[model samples]
Target: MNNKFGLSNEYTLAKVLQIKHYTRTLFSFKTTRPSKFRFKPGEFVMIGLILRGKFIFRAYSICSPTWHNALEFYSIKVPNGPFTSFLQKITTDSSIIIKTKSTGTLILDSLTPGKRLFLLCTGTGIAPFISIISDPETYIKYNEVIVVLTCRFSQELRYFNYKIKQLLKQPHIESHAKNKLRFYLSTTQEPYPYSGRITWLIKSGTLIADLNTYTLNKRDRFMICGSQQMILDVVNLLKSIGYIEGTINNPQDFVYEKAFVN
Candidate 1:
């Protein structure tokens, strides 16, 4: 039997505050956050629903900053996909099941002190970075933040780009965002500019060349989220260059998370 909004023992119900559809397959929604619920900028939590008394959930990275009163998530609509398909039914009047405890390898604590932080992602992998980039703590931790994203189509990039642009316009952070944050965007299936350089943009030095920034130094840190292959490719390249991975993250010169939600 379904309660007011499908209750579950391990999860709390959050009312949907708003929803925005960026594309036919891509959408973002906000939900009320429980006062005691807490998570780091890059953490992900289980979100889903209880159907027929069975709980179905998937890991979704929190897209909003830690200080926000509401939690936000960006999702891709996979046709007939497990959670995505079921998720299509929810609306502003709906309530969702959110596991209180959140966890992930992409948190800032995993990385040692560094001067430059590179956030590399593809497609919806950009979710966690959104929170990371907007967090004031991230600005305090690193002098510069560079975000690189690639997808098959330009529309797939609207979320990250829009969020970054929006952040640049905000009042207090405007100066820091403009002076410290940089974005490189591109589309693989088509010709568009992003941070990627050479045949493998994430692993190449082309971004520094294009940006006229300082060369890659040991003080630079990296965080990656994307397909498994993309993660492996970037990790291998970083390790080959002697970048030590986070000891907390199975030893990578970088930290990574697989966000294959589609």
Candidate 2:
């Protein structure tokens, strides 16, 4: 396959270690990681496979923390997507291609130090936040971590719910999350206790009321990932409240990335 694509040095082949299906359109898989592949928890890298004798790659956020030996990715299975249709069919031991470079704006370093870190996500946008929360440095940097995930269905929230429970059981993470971590799940099209777009929740003051915390302030930093419209809505709301957009070089009060490029 390497010879066929002429990608011997450009990409590394990783063996699929495990895979789990969360829904017809969503799944997660872990793959062997190259020892030299290092990246911040919230970074994203290009990954793909060969199909019809051609290399097909797509940018995907790394869901696993840097401390983990293997790499994990949460993906949406687009029925006709050139890369995902092929990716979703892989099983254990299947080989995949991962580019060596990883980059993104969602890392903790992109935001100024703050008392609370709010991770706002929708759909598979939860991927990068999974990595951020798993890293110990996140706990060290902020006194509080709040994760808000909104999806269209109740079942879509299952993976995050299960993962958070397991993460909270780990000896090191358990202590930090005991008092600092809060997870909120909401659905848009399905019946759930919390329903509606996150922007609405914020505007209605329902979110802060539920958390029993004061409204966002300068001490509260935010990282947002989701659909384009969702990101725009949230960004506008934050800016209206005086939150400044941040970057790797210029640390500010908030940062964001699109879940998938349209």
The model with the greatest TM-score is 2
Q: Per-residue CA lDDT of candidate 2, range 221-248, in tens?
A: 9999988889888999999988999998
Name every residue pair that clashes in candidate 2.
none
Clashes of 1: 9
Model 1 RMSD in angstroms? 2.8
What lDDT does the true structure give each of the candidates? Answer: 0.81, 0.89
Which pairs of residues collide in model 1?
184-194, 184-195, 185-193, 185-194, 197-201, 244-252, 244-253, 245-252, 245-253
lDDT of 1 by residue, 170-210 (tens): 67667657678887887877667653432376356677777
- Structural similarity to truth (TM-score) of each candidate: 0.90, 0.96
Model 1: residue 93 alpha-carbon error in angstroms: 1.3
